[model samples]
Target chain A: MDETDRLIINSLQGNFPICDRPYLEVAQQLGISEDELLSRLQTMLDNRTLTRFGPMYDIQKLGGSFSLCAIRVPAERFEEVTEIVNAFPEVAHNYERDHEFNMWYVLATESPEQITHTNQAIEARTGLKVYNMPKIQEFFVGLHFQA
Target chain B: MDELDRKIITATQAGLPLVKKPYAALAEQLGIDSETVKQRLRNMLDKGQIRRIGAVPNHYKLGYMANAMSVWNVPDDKIKELGNQLGALPFVSHCYERPRFLPEWPYNLFAMLHGKSREEVADKVQQVVKLLGEYCVGYELLYSKQILKKTGLRLKAKD
Candidate 1:
């Protein structure tokens, strides 16, 4: 990633314009042409520098639900269990953490009750306990990383 | 959201097209005008249904390899004040108050700290420790070993 790439990452994290020529407007602000900005963004995304490039929807506000769930898989079966847990379409984000609760993932469902439904399905499949840690309150969410 | 809005979301949820006229592309796909597509997105943004429209970078790939979810056991009454303070910190990305399962899990406050290395993360944790002081009964830094999956917020399409 060059200086221009860094500038693109930092500038476009949020508040991207909603106009017809949004990219053109952004490129102007960053002192780059629309074509250059588009190509840079495409390359960054292709290389996994930017995991996603689009609108971030608030699932809860849209009558959907989200819960952070974890599981403790035996060391030997970690990989197998990961495959099993991740097979569920509802498991949006999963991670291997350094703790007893080694596996952590977020479940995004269409409704509040689906949160429980998905957890139960995972437990039934994995035969391991799923700890659901739904947020009682959200204090913050947005954070920008200077690339 | 109406059916048209849902169609717009389903079309762009993956991403805006990498084209000169991205919204127009979406409109073309949905068989709607560019103006309507832009207006629905704007409306969703206004209603907070859409947080923002932009790039979501991979922090690990961006050199923020050391990201720790710092969980704290703080008194329920003090959480409101403490969570806000932690959230205000530039390094802390996400902060929230969650339910704690005693005996196994005892963390009510969760703050995500990002850094270039574990040492940097530990240093930030110290800042949080000092900020919490006596209110924090216990804490743990769960460093992620791997990102197994990270496809953000996918809504299943209607049948």
Candidate 2:
């Protein structure tokens, strides 16, 4: 990514204007034409540099529940367990980390009760205990990556 | 949210149309006016339903390859004070207080750190350690080896 691309990523991290000519406003601020700005954004997104560009809805506020869950799947059964876990629609994001709790995933359910139901189902399928660590309190979130 | 709002969300959840008049495009798709689309979005923003509207960069692609979930086991009584302090740190992206499952799991505080290198992330963890000198009983840095799945919130059709 070039300097202009970096600038676009940084500037557009938050507070994208809501107007008829929002792109034009941003393009002017970035000292680039609307076409250039749009083209660059398109390229970055197409190449997977920028994952998304839009409103980040707060699931909790939208009457949904988000919980950070983990599982200590044995090395031999890792893939099998992963398949079972990720099959659930509620499992939004899953990751493999270097820890005893090797598998970590976020469960985004439509309601608070659904979280438990999903977890229980996953455990029943995999026969592995699911560690549900829902946040008691959030101090902060949304970190801007400076490209 | 009303049916119109749901339609707007479902239309734009993947992304806002990458066009000069994105909202107008959305309005056209949803059979609504540009003004109404913008107003509802604005209302959601004000209501804290929408955190912000903008580019969500992929940290790994942006050179923040070394990311760690630094979990801490701190005194429950001093959690609020420590959580706020840790969360305020520039390097700490996400900080929260979570429940501790005793005998097996014992971390209540979670702070996420990201950097270009593992050494850089470890250096920041030292800062966190120093900050929690007395209160920090134990901690673990869970660096993600791979992302198995990362599809952010998908609101199923309410029909």
In model 1, the runs with Cα more than 4 Å from the true position are A76-84, A124-127, B148-151
Worst 10 residues of 2 chain A by lDDT: A56-65
The runs of at least 3 residues in candidate 2 whose Cα sits more than 4 Å from the true structure, single-residue gaps closed, are: none
lDDT of 1 at A130: 90
Cα lDDT, all candidates: 0.90, 0.91
Candidate with top DockQ is 2
lDDT of 2 by residue, A1-147 (tens): 989998999899999999999999999999999999989999999999999889998767777789999999999999999888888888999999999899999999878899999999998999999999999999988888889
lDDT agreement of model 1 with the native: 0.90
Docking quality tier of model 2:
medium
Give the Cα RMSD of candidate 2: 1.6
User: What are the per-residue Cα lDDT tens digits for candidate 1 across B29-113?
Assistant: 8888999988999999999989899999889898898889999999999999999998999999889999998889999999999
Q: Please write out the lDDT profile of model 1 over residues A77-119, one tens digit for every residue.
A: 9999999988998889999999998999999887889999989
In order, the interface RMSDs are: 1.8, 1.4
Collision pairs in model 2: none
lDDT of 2 by residue, B5-43 (tens): 778778888898999999999998888899999999999
